[model samples]
Target: MTAPTAPPPRSDAAVGTPPPTARPSLLRRVWTSYAFRRICQSVFVVWLVATITFLLMHLMPGDPIEIMAGRLNSSGMSHDQAMATAANIISYDPNANVWVQYLEFMRGLVTFDLGNSLTNPSKTVFEHVMEYLPWTLFAVGAGVVLAVVIGLSVGMAMAYRRGSWFDHVMTSIGSFLTGVPNYILIAAVIVVGYTMLGVLPFLDMRGRITAGVEPGFNFVFFGDAVFHAILPIIAFAFTATGSFMLNMKAATTEVLTEDYVTVAQARGLKAGRISRSYVGRNAMLPIIPQIALQLGTLVGGSIVIEQILQYPGAGQMLMAAISNRDYPVVQAAVIILATSVVIASLIVDLFLVRVDPRIKSEGQDA
Candidate 1:
């Protein structure tokens, strides 16, 4: 019986009996986790977003209905006629329910069918969007990339050599420029270009290429298009760079203080290697989400810059639509811009998950 004494209680017992591991099926875990809550939250957000968008048009000063009546009848129709006509154009039939309008708006969005533009006689709202979106992407996208690269590089250098003359100069410059409004900077850039530089960009707030010319990816048109885009790009990039520099510099400084970074240094890693690989990667996590939000903001505000530069981006089109009370065009542009922001944010969330596993797990939980 003593021989059985559990084999002397086995000195290697714990080693043989390892702790149980969690290996829940991926789908099963996700179903019961906070990820499900996040999806529900996103759906709720979309509902609120739709309601807000619908209300935005309603809140504008001049009634689109009245404006349409004025446009349709310059001689001034009777109140009854105007009312009837507005109802017709707006699809405000007496029998129609609020839910019907909401459903219609949602359907139009899903189908990418934005209907006609009341402002632009030459093309449908959809066609107008197609014409302008590319330039916006090219100009804004290039400017963003340039700003991020330049800002990140300078910020990293400044952070690594804090209190140096170069750092002082950059910090001062970034802080100074941060105070200047984008519109003022854009105006100044244009003024400088036209006056000091003696180079005015051929800014035509129309199609990407010259009209009456067949479109092709040839050097002639391509070069001219790029040349036209350069000044606006510079203006946007210059305006955006200060914020990027300041933010990245702050993040880098904060990340440099992290314990892991200290451990990295303790490992005898080269300064360049440690800075580029460790510091830079960690510093960039915060910047990624920021860049996503900035893109959406830039797209929304692009009209101001576009109008000043006379660039035919979607923002300019949106502005024109708003000015004319072009309901279809207005709705289309707003939806496009809103949807872009939502999609960009979603993509950023996914990216954040990848960059920092904590965000993924936490976001799922939230």
Candidate 2:
């Protein structure tokens, strides 16, 4: 009764103006979000990788300390002094329970302390990573970019020309290239360019740059770096382009058959315009995700290629670390690689969600 009486005196602002819209809190929004789940999944992936890497390193044959001691002995230290140095270098009790070591490793990760190199206790894991990561990024990045460009052009041409001789010829080549391993491709390139043709004297068969070229921001230095990187880039691009071409061709072929493309054709749209705005655009959707996902593999995939080329990249560093049984370096490299893959996958997932509404819908549904 009291409320009914008060209703007559209700303010116009309260009655006419709708109640203020209640916005969700940021924390609440994130807690309930698909993106948040994906992020958590990525974090879990990193943790799993770190854990596995740590366990494997510990389980592998030969002690890192022993390996270090042997190297120290070879470097002129007395056997006993080498043993002591090895112990000092490790700084932690290798005989400690595996769980304790894992906890320490996790703690170091939390603090961004990847520990010092077992072989060279003076240099930290981060230092080594920073030293090697850039070269890999440069060579691998150049390769990926070139591969994408070549693939898209070739793939689109094939799709448009379908059963033409050009299409058949390219498809066959792509198939052949895709079947060949990256190392095999690298060896073939080296053989063909340096051995058979002998025309590429500028192609540095080893190292990222000329040995005496001082590292700087100068054109000469950068040009030298580029010169050294050419063969590796070509090798990586040749190995990768085939997959991209095949994927793009398949995607383009499928897209061309869609009703919207058919309707666009019936409307007498220009071939170029239709191809660019309709067929090409739609076809690229699948390829975009592939490109994003492929970024992760580029790091790991470069290992053999880098090893063969003697490129001073992360892959080469990783190989060196493994050979030396450098625990900290190996752990750090694995972590970096795993993190990269997880991050790439996360980026692609988020990108797909934004660009393709269907992905968002599916995420919401899940």
Candidate 3:
């Protein structure tokens, strides 16, 4: 009997393949990556941000003591009380050095003790900022997620069906919507919401709902707040979605030209299957960092949308703090916002490296 034919030699060995290189351990690789360097840079940036924020707040023309007391002639406090309050507000004393004051401020941040609000002495800066941060996050968060989902999907579809009627339709709609500023859209939405839809009242700037009621799922206050949030959310989403859509379209268009995509199509892959599983998947890489960058922008920008909607969100607090020259509030807000931005960028950097190994390898080469 013919000798049993040896199973076909494995092509890798048949071609005299070299032994695989031993890859570095995950931890070691990460330690050497650009991401690690970026994180280190971020720590220095935070310190610099904190120092600059403190100096700027202190340098700005105006006294938190005067702002807090409401006047140089306020009758409630004697000279001693006023001086004590001023010292406390400024974190200074006759005996304390600048280093001491800065060290004390940094210590306070560790404990979430941001001191008293110069804009409103009835509350602490932490309380004032924390109270509104939630609402701002809610509004901005909802808008961003909505924009990404709607925009990316639309853009993918437009790009896939380039020059089709649907593509032209989306392009026109995106152009029109993007042309209108968020404030204008919010105004129109408010008018229609109140006058036409009769679904919700105008946004309340005084605070989220009347002060007495707690925010819960079952209350009219909550309902009213959500209804009011809709217009601002829509306005924010509309203005932002167009950019996401345009970017996604560009990314997807580039991805669709890859040889792998053509090969998949030749292999009898369904159009929908290839689009979602292949093209769309790869196209999302660029979008990831972009989304993080947008998050930073939105955090800084939420105040504008919040003000327009008369929403008692972080934006409103920022506006009030700026108008009153409440250095404490302004400094705290800037530090918090700046720290967030830097952290977001760092997270995005790491995420991109994780999603695309090329980033890590290329970074090493660089």
TM-score of each: 0.79, 0.89, 0.79
For candidate 3, write residues 76-101 as lDDT tens digits: 77766776776576552334476887
Residues 181-299 of candidate 2 have per-residue lDDT tens digits of 87887787678878899975734557877878999999999998998888778877886799888888999999988999999889999999998999887788888877756676677
Distance from true location, Cα of 18 in model 3, Å: 14
Q: Which stretches of candidate 2 lie over 4 Å from their true place?
A: 1-25, 72-78
Q: Which candidate order results from sorting by lDDT in descending order?
A: 2, 3, 1
List the lowest-lDDT window of 10 residues for candidate 3. Answer: 87-96
Q: If both were scored by lDDT, which would come out higher, candidate 1 or candidate 2?
A: 2
lDDT of 1 at 140: 82
RMSD list, candidates in order: 4.7, 4.4, 6.8
Cα lDDT for residue 2, candidate 2: 50
lDDT of 2 at 34: 81
Highest-TM-score candidate? 2
Task: Give candidate 1 regions above 4 Å deviation.
Answer: 1-27, 32-43, 59-99, 119-124, 202-207, 211-213, 364-366
> Worst ten-residue run, lDDT, model 2?
1-10
